[model samples]
Target chain A: MIEIKDLQKNFGDTKALKGVNLTVPDGELFAYLGPNGAGKSTTIRILTGLTKISKGRARLGGYDIEKEPRAAKRQFGVVHQHVNLDPELTVFENLDIHGQLFGMSKAARRARIKELLDYIELTGRAATLIKQLSGGLKRRVTIARALLHEPGIIFLDEPTVGLDAAIRRRIWALIKKIQLRGTTVFLTTHYIEEAEFLADRVAFLDKGRIIALDTPANLMAMAGAWAIDQFKDSGMQTHYFKDRKQAAAFQTDDSFTLRRVNLEDAFLSLTGKKVQP
Target chain B: MINECLAIYRREMLILKRRLIRQMAGQAVSPLLYLVTFGYAMGDKIRFDGISYLDFLLPGLVAMSSMTRSFAIATDINVARFYWHIFDEFQAAPISNVSYVAGEVLAGMTRALMGIIIILGLGLLFGVHLAYGPMFWLPILLNSFLFASLAVALAMLVKNHADQSLLVNFVITPMAFLGGTFFPIARLPGWLQSILKLLPLTHASKAIRQAALGKPVNLHSLALLAALGAVIFLIALGCVNRARD
Candidate 1:
């Protein structure tokens, strides 16, 4: 659904995206992950046509973003990191206005708003002003607003930040449902667990560059945090292997078990910082 | 493209209509304050061609309202950038660049018109005079739209809200004061009078005050303002497109 090649974006003396290249297939849930200022957000901005490229080419659904921006934009739904809803408008009105932006008719907008309200569980709060809703609810409405056009791809920039665990889980579940409908999901998240749970493929970025890219399980397995903790009658023994593959492939029988690692451990090993708890 | 612009226009008008009372209150109260303060409280002592200060000040107050409405529009462009992130949304959408610019300009124009319209209505209540014909609205409307466009352009160019406000206070306010808003430009020295002729609002004030005081329209002043407005609008657009780069 999306293709970017030799993407070089510079802001004055600072290079935000340095010769970056990425491709996201249709119906794939891809997470672009990195620490702060790793150019993850920059890459997303470029993909969504919010920023100009210093040099390179980007195509969405076969339409060039620079040459045919309108067509390219028509292919994706976008939800930015910041919640930018009109606090003065009702939840339904907010969605309705967005629908109208894309040329949706009043009746079509009404039916779509109702469907989105139900999907986001904001039906009762439909007539209430957005400022009256909680942060989680506001975020849901933003998601609903993005889907008003039913685009082929959804570009979500950190959609689950600052939410409680239950709300995060619910949002994640909703995202999974979006993925199940065969829409491409391109997201950038500071939340390690979010990338782990929702991403079919994760790209590790650092300093405007992608250092590593693979599935979450693959990256974790590739992080190579190998350990051997042995139990004896007198004392317990803990041993660290040179690499994860060694520990992962080490012999295990009924008496002992080989452990499995997740994206957090992989992130810590690769980036040398603890993932956000 | 024009259709998209009309959509934006309608959306803005709807917001103004939905908050009609609030909009009226906001626009009406400020000009009324100026009318009361300058027309009645400080109507004595100051003279222009042996005329009372109220007569001199009322026209100034009218021009001030127009300029201030332009400022208001410029400052509020942050609505899209900071509040709704509508600019970001537009950057990604299938909307044309003209539509994006038109949406903001139309909103600003409407606000400027509101300020001008209210000032016209209140001018009569305060015993302040204006051109009687409906044709007087021509220059007033054009002046408001051009200045409003300039303001929206400034909004797009300024890096932050604080910077935008500083420009309004330091540049816009000074221009209004020096452009014969509060007094007669004829009192100035020959060199300064020549410089004042270059200012858009100088010509704007010249055109508006003449039409109000029942003098023949100054074609040269009208031409100068229109040309100046065209140049400023083009420059503003250049600033906006450059910022995008």
Candidate 2:
């Protein structure tokens, strides 16, 4: 339900994004992956109407962000990389305030906060100051804050950074539950496994360009079997393929040698193992 | 617009009220020190436009309290929020930018007004007095809000703690000193006096002291300060919205 056309942003002499474009269908879990400073946050910021796109237009749910910022923004829920809770407030109050800003009534806000609190498993510390909470709890509060309004599209920027494995898995499950409920999620993450597991379709962004865009498995199939075998270097042989029929060959192998193409391999193949911003 | 602003105001009020004693006590130091420095050391020797230094300095001291109080809030609370990324919540929220600016302006005004009140209270202990009545609050509130808005604008633009302190010295100190806070601009030569009249606080002080000394109300001075204040407030809101955008 979102379309971006040639989004470009410039900060003085630095060109952050150059003619970047993409789309996300309704209820699609679209992952935007890029190295740091590759304009991932800039694109998200523009989509939210927080920053001006120097040379392009962006639309959310068919509404132009610049012309219909309020309406566009109303349909968006964002969880920035930073912990977006007021440190002075309690966990429940953070969600409540977030809901209230979108014009929710107190009774509704109260019920919603309680529901979200239970969703994130923070009911016990609902009364504690955000500053007093652990990092995982605060991140959960941020995710809960994003989901409070139940917008059609939820945007997460590096949502799991600094989170422990257990908490990260829990949050990933939370996101999966959200998608199951039919919310479109547009997310960016450095963790290849996250993109592989969560994103329905992934976009590899390099140097402000979409180098590759496909399902995780399809991209992996591009990594030939011989190379895959050589890379795996295992007693258990690795079988790979150029297409889906051949891709299933690994599954049928007696040695159980299998080729699984995730985002990390796709990323390495498209843009060598070198950094790009 | 006002309701969202009220939410921000209420949040700030919660912080201030929870630490009411501590907040009030911290504000007392600056004004009290200024009071003693001007009222005790120079009150006897200085005379300007037919008044002792303490008597002349009182109105200015009251205005300065508001000025510094507002600056102090932005410096301590608002600045820290930006650095810690606590401000990201507000940016991502549904609250209007104007409402956010108004809420923060209200916080600054509250602290500044408190400082002004503390100085006024201490004034009575000096056994020196000006006309004290409810009517006096009009000018006081006007000047306090005016300066507080300016402080909010500065907070949105100023780079760091160093720039913050520099503003207090370079901008506010000069405005207080040259704007007839302690002595009448009429005593200066015509060229200097004309330049002094351009200052917003000059009009702020004139309106304040006119009400304080129970003199006839000066509509011109009140209008000028109010107009300058309104412009700065609008510009400040615009700057904040731009920074956010």
Candidate 3:
């Protein structure tokens, strides 16, 4: 389980995270969504030991992040937003080093890495260097590296930022498989469909504060069941309705079309801004 | 802590081993050129305390190689920081800052040892042998340690590779030339010699040269090198902590 209370981050005179509070129970896939500069990366950095926490407390698996950093860090794995693997190293070497850093014995690392390779369906590509792999393949290997230590919780920051739709779906399936095995997964992404399709619950953060938090279905329901995008010279405006009949009733021309409301619509309805620039 | 240190060291060694051939060629070229050119230009013409200039030049070359090879770690660190983002992984890992610095420093010392070996081989080809005793090696290790720690400290402070290169040009390059490596510091003017003595490499070169000549080495120089190394090592730990912050 992950818990954070009254978290705040300040950079000189600028405030990045402002008195944020959140908790994620074990075995839950929680998605944190926000636009750029919403403190998503700062929160992950503080939790993962990459940055110092200015204020508040964070705990992982009941271990305090600031007081018991090593213990807390050992309880969770992180896949950063960027592909930080050593490009000069082979896939197996990358995972092997991660296991070593976590203090896994050689025999244990070998066994675990082999199992993860098969689990990620990259058993044959273990010997390939990271630089030689495609972007999607590299993302998969990055995920596999994170799981090598078998931590109870995993934090993934934008794991599939630049992949195609097909590749993104494949990664989503992998994520579901991971969550099914009862690991608490904390994820941050810009893809609304990704959160809608995979997240057990979603939190919307803007300007360093979470504006909304609930299940994707519940959040979308709050924005009504259906939405119509009205195109105009000013801009595209979306109108939400409680049902499809109400949404169709508001459409006057071919430029308007009705569809089910998504998490993005819920975010926009709550914050009056798009989730992506 | 030991396990974490070994993990980081193992990563560096693995990468070094992969490119060992190219790295070996790069390491061998510069010292070989120096040995041939300087040995021919002034081998028999001048003598320091009746020792042939080539013999004097050999130990100096070894000391310089140790310093340069150890300090070269900054470049690798900058590459990992700016391009591969490998340091980010380490920052997020369970490894402590001290362990990270220790691992990289050890790897730097290893590179220095490799270069020392290559220089010794070239010296042998030229029939220039020195007293390879503990007195020689103790100072070499201390020299390597000091420079490697400095490398790690600077590597963590610099923002990018270009900035790293600028530091090298301003810091390491000048020390390599004027730190009693290629010539005797005593030959310089009194004021200039005073300035050169401030460099760690000056003491290292003097100590190594004395040991190579089968003479009693200066304990003050060795002590100074060790003291400087410890101070720089602590600075490295501080820089790493700051970088993590």
Candidate 4:
């Protein structure tokens, strides 16, 4: 479980996070959705103790991140937004070092590394250097490394950002499997579909503030189940309807098309800005 | 904390093992050139404290190599921080700032020890032998500790690889040449001697050369080095903490 209260972060004259508050309960897969520079990574960094918070308090598994950093850090595994594995080291070596950093015994590290390599389905590539692996494989190895010490929570920041659609789905399945294992998962992403497909609850963050928070179905239903997009001389406009027949009836011109309302439409209807930059 | 430091230190040792041969070859080339061009060229023409020029140059080479090799950790730190982003891995882990700095300093010391062995081997081949005693290692270690601690502090302060290289050019290069590694500081002007004598490497060179030649070691220089190393190490710890923020 993670708890944040009135969190604020500032860099000189600019504020990165402004009086933001959030709580993620145990075993919940919560997605913090935002565009670029939307304070998603900043919140994660503050929670993980990577960056100092300018104001407010954060607790990870009941340990204060500022006052009890070591204990707080021991409670969570962080898969950073960027690839941070040692390139010269082998896959097993990377996991081994991480386990050792957590004070895991040698035998424990050996067993965990073996289990995780198999879990990530990289048993054959355990001996390969990180630089030798493909992008998707590297991402999997990073995730595996994060889980080596068996922390209670996992913070994944844009885990599948640049990966192809197929690889992204594979990661999505892995995330589901991780959540099923009873670990609380906190994920941040700009991809609307990722949040919709994987999260139990979603929070929309923009300009250092949380604008909307709810289940995917609830957020979509608040707008409508169906949508009609109409193109005019000025620009394209979309209208949401509760019924499929009504949405179809709203499409009068050849330029108009009827489709199901998605999380993106919910975000647009709520904030008047696209979820993706 | 000790276990965490060793974990980081062990990773560096493993990487060093893979590149051991190439590193040894690279370490040998520069000292060999200096020995041939400077050592052989002025073999008997120059004498310091009644010892041959080559003999006097041998210990200075050891001191210089130890300082440079230990200082090389800054480059490694910069690479880990900027390119590999490995420092972020450590930051997110449960390790303390002290553990990270201690681990890196030890790795630097190990590299310095390796360089000392290589230079001593080269000295034997060139027929320039000297005393290898406890006093010899004590000052060498203190010197390595000094530079390596400085290296970690500077690495934390630098913004990028280019900034790191600029630091080496401005700080380490001058100390290498003017710190009595290639020539005696006594030969310089009195005012310059006073300034160079303030350098930690100068005291390192003086103490190491004295211990090598069976001369009376200056306790003041050794004390100064120990004091400086301790202070710089604390500064490096502060820098590591600041860098994480």
DockQ score of candidate 1?
A: 0.45
Model 4 alpha-carbon drift over 4 Å, by segment: A232-234
TM-score each candidate. 0.89, 0.88, 0.98, 0.98
Query: lDDT values of the candidates?
Result: 0.77, 0.75, 0.92, 0.92
Predicted structure with the largest DockQ when compared to the true one:
4
* lDDT (C-alpha) at residue A127 in model 1: 86
| Residue A95 alpha-carbon offset, candidate 3, angstroms | 0.9
Instruction: Give the clashing pairs for model 2.
Output: A220-A261
Judge the docking of candidate 3 as incorrect, acceptable, medium or high.
high
Q: Give the per-residue lDDT digits (tens) of candidate 1, residues B1-245.
A: 66556656666665567677987888899778877886678777577877777766666666666667765766555775766776676566677766766676667767777877787788778777656564455556567667877886788787778888798788788887898887888899999999987777787777777777777878887776667667766676665555564
TM-scores computed on chain B for all candidates = 0.88, 0.88, 0.98, 0.98
How many steric clashes between backbone atoms does each model show? 1, 1, 0, 0
Full candidate order by DockQ, most accurate first: 4, 3, 1, 2
**Tens digits of lDDT, candidate 4, B1-245:** 99999998998898898789999999999889888888988677887778888998999999998899999999999999998888888888898888988899999999999998999999999998799899988999999998899999999988889999998899889999999998899999999999998999899999999999888889999999999999999999999867755
Model 2 misplacement above 4 A: A224-260, A274-277, B41-53, B76-81, B158-162, B186-189
Tally clashing residue pairs in candidate 2: 1
* lDDT tens digits, residue span A1-277, model 1: 8898998889999998888788989999999887778888888887888788899999999999888888888899999988877777788767776776777778998998898899887777788988799988888888888898999999889898888999999889989998998999998987888998999999887778777788887887765446454667775444445566777566464434455556666766677665463
Give, for candidate 4 chain B, the lowest lDDT window spanning 10 residues. B41-50
Scored against the true structure, residue A259 in model 3 reaches a CA lDDT of 91
Winner on TM-score between 1 and 2 is 1
